[model samples]
Target: MLADTKKVGGFLLLAAALLLNGCKEEKAEVGAAAPALAAYDLQGNPASLEKWQGKHVYLNFWASNCGGCLVEMPVLEKLSKEFGDSIVVVGINTDKEEMNIQALLDERQVSFPNVRDQLAITQERYQVIGTPTAFLIDPQGKLTGQYIGMLHEPELKAIFEKSRQKG
Candidate 1:
């Protein structure tokens, strides 16, 4: 009985160690090339991150239910307009309900290219653990920076400038 108990304890320790290793955060390098992404636009058209190459891309992970996302969308829209064709801003909504996300976009007058991550696959791929996470990708398709909250205009502009410099 004592031998069996020891074996079980050892197994538990091994399992715990494996779990902790799995939970380690992946460190993504800034200026690293962006990974290929296949996701859908708000209109349900198939879109690829590669399509936005040769332009600075701002990718935002959002949800209709998130308050911060609500505030950030308009800011993103303004930036999108200011940047014009020089940059592309994409809002990837993680909301499972299509209607809710669409309604919010319409009400907010979100002008940027918006997408829906129905299965949250993009979230998992980008390692996005929270709403309002933004990734700035340079014209050469390299990741320049990541912002993880309500972004003020100045900070976003700084990231945009950094991406521009990468080109």
Candidate 2:
């Protein structure tokens, strides 16, 4: 009986380790080039991260059902317009239904270029575990920081400001 108990305990420990590792936070080193991303927007427009080269980019991963994601939209929109020339804010929506994604965009009045990632390909590449995951990439396409969850205006401003200072 004791042997069986020890065996179960070891199995549980190993399972926990694997589960934790799988859900580990995504980290893109500051000096490493951003991961490759290629997908179509809701309008069926092909877009890639390289297209926004030479500019700071806010790569945001979101889902229509995520309330925090909905809250982050306007904040990102404001940043997108305010820093139009200096930065590019790209929203990658992980909604399975393209039509539903469009309706949410229309209702939210979000103007930034939003990529459709129904297959979760981009999310997997970015190692996103939840909604409102944002990465700050510099002009050279190197990642500067990764933010998970809703980000306020000031936080967003600081990221942009830092990138500008570096440039």
Candidate 3:
């Protein structure tokens, strides 16, 4: 009888542990504001987010090694051309090597803002769990929307239009 009681008690404890774990919430870091991105342009000029204010910004987190990012680069390039002045599409490199990123960009002919994640601070602050994560920030500097994985040109255009309206 004691052994059966102990078994039941252990089962209850396991269920309680599972329930507590399920209740855990993602905690945003204190004073966590918009990620500060200071990556360089193709010409080695400093590209900062401050320069992108008063316009819709599409910040894309990707790496040269990511297969999905390779496929999305062209679509992003097309979108950048279409919404040239209305929106800014900035690509953040998640790879550790700068040369690899530069090579990919050169091969793809990507002319948008290309920055490298030197410290991975932005990734951690944004809680980015996957490659090809895109954050849509309004002109007012508020996070308006987030997209994960490869994005289509039309979808990006739609988001840019929406941000313009809000601006």
Better of 1 and 3 by lDDT: 1
Collision pairs in model 1: none
Residue pairs clashing, model 2 = none
Q: What is the TM-score of each candidate against the true structure?
A: 0.76, 0.78, 0.72
Instruction: Name the regions of candidate 2 deviating beyond 4 angstroms.
Output: 1-28
Tens digits of per-residue lDDT for model 2 on 62-150? 88788989887888888788778788899988878535777778888998888887756567768888988989898888988899999
Instruction: Give the alpha carbon lDDT tens digit for every residue of 17-89 in model 3.
Output: 7865443322223223355554565566766678988888888999876888888888888888877777888
At residue 78, candidate 3 shows an lDDT of: 84
Write the residue-wise lDDT of candidate 1 on 31-97 in tens digits: 6766555468766787788778789889898887788888777778887887756888988888784
Using lDDT, rank the candidates from best to worst.
2, 1, 3
Report the CA-based lDDT of candidate 2 relative to the real structure: 0.81
Candidate 3: residue 32 lDDT (0-100): 34
Report clashes for each candidate as comma-separated counts: 0, 0, 0
